[model samples]
Target chain A: DVKVTQSSRYLVKRTGEKVFLECVQDMDHENMFWYRQDPGLGLRLIYFSYDVKMKEKGDIPEGYSVSREKKERFSLILESASTNQTSMYLCASTTAGANTGELFFGEGSRLTVL
Target chain B: GESVGLHLPTLSVQEGDNSIINCAYSNSASDYFIWYKQESGKGPQFIIDIRSNMDKRQGQRVTVLLNKTVKHLSLQIAATQPGDSAVYFCAETGSGNTGKLIFGQGTTLQVKP
Candidate 1:
């Protein structure tokens, strides 16, 4: 089983503060993703990495950035957190694309920006 | 923009009954569809998936049906339990090797005992 671990379960930060959400996978998967889950707007991809030091912006990547310094570690960074950024953040990984494969997800991190 | 969407926002069914959740997608190029279940305070978990070449696929206690003509997807759960009560989202992927998924607006399922 692939284990994806997020650094925080709940996070609180003030507006304009820099925030970091970390995710690490034990399995040497080639793909990692960061998504934000909102009430009416399902899970929108924020960023995804196909390999170490490689990242791509997803649909909603305005207020967020990502890092994949290592194969097992992927990170989401909020350069300046805003109240609108308060939402549940999720981390996911897969050995490859959805060639009938599933994406293993971590327990989400709820961010509350004040 | 091409995206995935659900027909209903919520569905309530009696315990032990069957539940069907429907999803609509606008992207015809989407070759992969997946159903995910997210319980309270948790991330979405993979339930089942169907490829573009297949019409239906079955997993443990769950079945996914895909209609490529209409770009519609449905998830059927057998003997729905309280644990089956969760938000279900259907995802579609088009022309991507990064496993990038566009998720639908979720359908919340409630199983009453």
Candidate 2:
């Protein structure tokens, strides 16, 4: 079984504060993704890393950045947290092998910005 | 803009009945689709998937059907149980090799006993 773990399940931060969300996968997948899910808006991609040290901005990457220092870990950073930035953050990983391309996801971290 | 969307925002079903959720995608280039179930306060879990080449695929109790001509997708859960209650989202991937997926808004499924 593949396991994707997120460092925090819930977080609270003040406006303009810096926040970090961490995710780790044990399956050694090559692709990692960060997504923010909102009601009626769906899961919008924030950033993704296809390999170590390589990152790509997704549809909504503003005010967010990501880091991939190792194959097992991917981190998402909120440069300046704002009230509107509060959302359910999800981390996902996919193995490099198949065409099915199913992603294994971690339990999401719900961030609240006040 | 090219995107994936759900036909319904919510669906209610009685236990032991069959449930069907629908989604539509505007991107004809999408080659892969996946169905996910997300419980409250948790992340979405992969329920089943179907590729563009195949029109239908079945899992333990879930089936995914894809219609390329209409760019429509559906997930059918047979003998739906209370455990099946969740928000179901259909996601499309144009390039699986690159691991890019565009997800729909999602349909919340409510199971009644």
On lDDT, the candidate that comes out on top is: 2
Regions of model 1 farther than 4 Å from truth: A97-100, B96-98
**What are the candidates' C-alpha RMSDs?**
1.3, 1.3
Please give me the total number of clashing residue pairs in predicted model 1.
Answer: 0
Which TM-score does chain B of candidate 1 obtain? 0.96
True contacts kept of each: 0.69, 0.61
Chain B TM-score against the true chain B, each candidate: 0.96, 0.95
TM-score, candidate number 1: 0.96
TM values, all candidates? 0.96, 0.96
- Candidate 1 deviates by what RMSD? 1.3
Q: Look at candidate 1 and tell me the lDDT of residue A76.
A: 97
* Reference-based lDDT, residue B89, model 1: 95
